[model samples]
Target chain A: MRTELTERFGIDYPIFGFTPSQEVAAAISRAGGMGVLGCVRFNEASELDEVLEWMHENTDGKPFGVDVVMPAKIPTEGSKVDLESMIPPEHRAFVERTLDDLGVPPLPDGNRVDAGVLGWLHSVARSHVDVAMAHARKYGQIKLIANALGSPPPDVIGVAHDNGVQVAALAGAKDHALHHVEARVDIVIAQGYEGGGHTGEVTSMVLWPELVDAVGDRAPVLAAGGVGSGRQMAAAIALGAQGVWMGTYWLTAAEYRLGATGDGPSTVQKALLAASSRDTVRRRIYSGKPARLLKTKWTDAWDAPGAPEPLPMPLQNLLVGEAHARISQADDAGVVAMPAGQIVGRLNSITPVAELIADLVSEYQESAARLGKTLD
Target chain B: MRTELTERFGIDYPIFGFTPSQEVAAAISRAGGMGVLGCVRFNEASELDEVLEWMHENTDGKPFGVDVVMPAKIPTEGSKVDLESMIPPEHRAFVERTLDDLGVPPLPDGNRVDAGVLGWLHSVARSHVDVAMAHARKYGQIKLIANALGSPPPDVIGVAHDNGVQVAALAGAKDHALHHVEARVDIVIAQGYEGGGHTGEVTSMVLWPELVDAVGDRAPVLAAGGVGSGRQMAAAIALGAQGVWMGTYWLTAAEYRLGATGDGPSTVQKALLAASSRDTVRRRIYSGKPARLLKTKWTDAWDAPGAPEPLPMPLQNLLVGEAHARISQADDAGVVAMPAGQIVGRLNSITPVAELIADLVSEYQESAARLGKTLD
Candidate 1:
């Protein structure tokens, strides 16, 4: 009856959902759980503000959270990330040709706005976080601040705690999980290999217990990666996890803003199968940051024998951003891949957000019942 | 460049392995491949001889095989199978008394074998195949036959193949791999799901492409489920396979066999950290048949409420023969519940057989290069 995270997150069930849409997030929270909005995709500042304002008017004051990226590596250090000039011309040419072949529109040749992953670094991520905070204050119910990439920098951590908002970060390994603990972070989310964005070798079943052991009594471990069903949620809890952090599951939720077509993660199972671990070819093709995704012709071209390699953070971000925007909206998906975790095999059908949450709880109850009898 | 098996089996490689040891028929004709033994902890006379002696002696003088079940799968086949009699009321009563108190066993008890599986279909597995065909006639060569339970069946498949004798087999999913296509049966084996005895399931990364997919392609596939070593091998190749089978990958190699101490699997990093997917669980009590192994005690009482009941065939075997053997051995393992498929974890160290075979072609090339590259 008394697990640390159950009370901390204020939920009857310790299931946390992450999504790129606000409606899905709010619904998960309103269903007696927590939902965090993924905040890195908005290309403009006003867009971020607009979404947050909408979230404020809609949530009816339920608890919610925001997520951003702060990877361990970056291209530059300064108040602003000037992404336009950092990428090489050859890379840009290749992307331009790919877009042309894809029949997607190119930006007008004129006054350049900051262009790639470098175009969306701490400056961009923080801008969205600022939007999250202003709106959280307006609504007075946002309960947490989470870093989707690496550790939350000291300043971000300090600010969130000051605002009575719990700060959380993602970790791919046991060592990284410890980094979260030593930093006094409220949660050290130990992710397994089957998660959506970035992940590591161990599976959720194997990693959950390891994290519980490593973080002993220090931080409540929020298990992330490879979770898409109620049985899985129950299994995680049976293995000692205090809560479950989920993202990929929400991609198919009805209220999410993503289009029904060409969302690589949506039709994932139909295309790929049988990789030892995953088609996790790390490329700075999106956000100019080295991210894992299903393999595609776009990645193969960069990895081809003679292609110019990817640049670091912001520069790669600058180089790939527009291309990301274009391809995501195009039909040549085989030529361009998208971010995904290995759990895609199980991401088969679509269901409503509230139904998904309710099913998970019911399944969790069933699994617990199964496990309890075995122990008894 | 030459090893005993290479010359004997007349193939480029001599690493023979498979799940069901009696698959001596299909394994032998798996051209240029070897079929070891396993899965016959509960074998019969006719079943073993037909496939081993009858089939092996007739297959274009090609090598054939047999294997045995050692550790892994707690609940072997039970009355669910067509046994002459169900595990006596006394046996069931004894099983109940043993499980009064215990949590997670010494393990998570990956997978368990039940006695109800074979359900008293008392037939000599390839073990009898190994035994009944003593001196059938000479053949191209019997690469090898191995076993997970006791030593060389009644007559190791090699003896029947004559002077150019060779044999091998491992446990775990070995049951699924034991069928001969066409060839003189030479080997019978058993490779545990765990790294020792019979095993399965836990170590997903270990590879034994030889057994899992050899049928119809010349020889038959050879697998010992919990094989451990390379990360990429986990991407097993059943590419052009008739069937894919496995067992845990741990054993009594020339240097590691026991010296009357009733040896258990090694605990080195290669074994311990291998992976549970290649491990096993204590299933049946052992002598009565369910495999005796190291694992969680969960499998011992699978009939608990709401637990999906296991079926027959191999299920009852877990609780019969092997369970009895463990109790007689008075090994504390009796309570640990023997079935094991997670043996791959103990497969940390490599022995001469498989390593030598995989390396043979490379070594042959190395030798050829020393002599110059154009021999072909």
Candidate 2:
């Protein structure tokens, strides 16, 4: 499959894979699509810098991208202790109670959670940009710096452009995309409500075309949300998206498990593998914004009566960081908080990233051919 | 544009337009797509039979269909009085309070809201089927009968088949479609959450392909949701839908305003035409089940804190039926409760039904060509 995105990036296909694992990102790049490594997990620029170095060596000279959590409206920057203090006591008590009820053990000695909200702060995102610019100048391997929440600030966009790197931002609504285009972002990723993580109320079927029409030629539109297969890719292209920005489908990739901290498939991956499309809920407990997540016991608890309202962005993450770490360590699939889309129904097995990309390409081809036949 | 639905009905395109107006339905059928008249508004079989007669005369010998709300599990059949009494006083008070707050006028002298829940009664749906079967046998214009809620009872499906009418049912998930296929539903419409009226939680982008895969060869899948443009039609086809089952787009048809009881465009139509895709809310107030509707003051009032929870199905309709009539008569666009999908954003102008159908055909062709070019 080819489109404006493929031509712009000189990639073979119009699929852009977003994953937290550098290995999965590199695999997607080597397999002819852009693999975007999510940088939000890194607490410090040095950690991200080391990961980018590893990506530069392992990507086989192919271009890959990095995604960072940079809110358009910058939040107050502070130390971890200061951030933790902002979280309400009631909210902390609720999290502690839920984690205890779920039987999630405390972190082992010397494993305290730190810098949980650092990536969310504007200062930390500036550091992330500094690291990305350095890699762009040194090896010319950092081709894209994508902002996960919305458009990066104008100065950040300017810095990326000056460093010869493209900028992408996620918009869940047409008006937001228009603002992104106005902000002069290089690419607009229109993430619909059915997508994993942060999203808006509109579905992909309605949002993709609306954004394409609204953005016009100002920026290329990448359709995200519930796009797991080649048929879905064709649907996105048919709706005038230049490409697909997929994240949830990559959570089950074999390489994702390899790069994960655990020895075997994590609970998140297992839950995703067994889930149907109906097994997802759009809850605000994830990041204080509406995000589609697996309908796990943990999510259910937050939605249950008497559960405290989740705080805003960085605060919500701060409140739940330790609980998340404990749940991950507990290795129970029922209560782990994993951001996934309705497309979880289609991803039933753990395939290698390359195989998954190949399947998408073929499925896209078959779908395109099928549409052509219908026209005939 | 040829697919199983188009070929089965010998229509030129695979668009199935669902509208409550006989004029709009006939116009769609005459313009090369099958227009299915929504029968839920008719409280009596005689009224529906007369409307079918009008449709038979107006459709220019083209095949048409009718949609009836035959809930899979039939609700307790009751008289309007019985249904009215079942609604609690608190729910009735909430409706009255909302109407008063919106300043909606009560019905004028000599007018009364009667049989509001009759069409929703299982007995009424059976009568609807009887009228449709009669038309199928007499005129052969009633080519398809679609059940709006899940699969029709086996006896209903058998009756339609005996009368040589094909049966279609709406499903929001793969398992629901599978049950429909097992019940021998001739067509399965995968109605996504973005669809208007009663709907399930899954969006079309994920649900269509899931239903298609599950109902493979057992029944053809017709995609129903936020399909407003030809590009959306192409997307639906690419995702394995045999055709598009559209409803919300018809609300703005010029012919609809002609049939509506108003001097000009009704308040509901005005609200729909002015709405953006983001202006819709999925709420249970429209029906007892979650249905997408225009974000109007009436719906907002119900969602507000201190508002009584909407009762289930017939009871909800009974409680709010008079309030709906008052809102309609008051001609206030801001407070009307109208079922509409996110595609309302694209339907800005009141175009003729034939012109709309023609545009969709050309758009579908263009989108298919666009996808072909991408493959190159």
Top candidate, metric lDDT: 2
Instruction: Pick the DockQ winner.
Output: 2
Clashing pairs in 2: none
- Per-prediction DockQ: 0.02, 0.87
- Kindly report the root-mean-square deviation of model 2 from the true structure over all alpha carbons: 1.4
Per-residue CA lDDT of model 1 for A16-63, tens digit only, reads 888778888887887777888777777677976787777667776678
Instruction: Give the Cα-based TM-score of candidate 2 against the true structure.
Output: 0.98
* TM-score against native, each model: 0.54, 0.98
- Residue A92, candidate 1: alpha-carbon lDDT: 83
Root-mean-square deviation of candidate 1:
21.4
TM-score of model 1 (CA atoms): 0.54
Clash count for each candidate, listed in order shown: 239, 0
Interface RMSD of each: 23.4, 0.8
The digit string of per-residue lDDT tens for model 2 on B1-376 reads 6787788989999999998889999999999999999998889899999999999889888999999988765465567787777888888777777788888877886366853456777888889999999999999888899988878988988988998899998999877889889999999999999998878889999999999999889889999998999999999999999999999999988899632575677667878888999898988886687889889888889889999877788677777777776777787789877889989999888889989998888899999999999867
Model 1 residue B239 lDDT score: 13
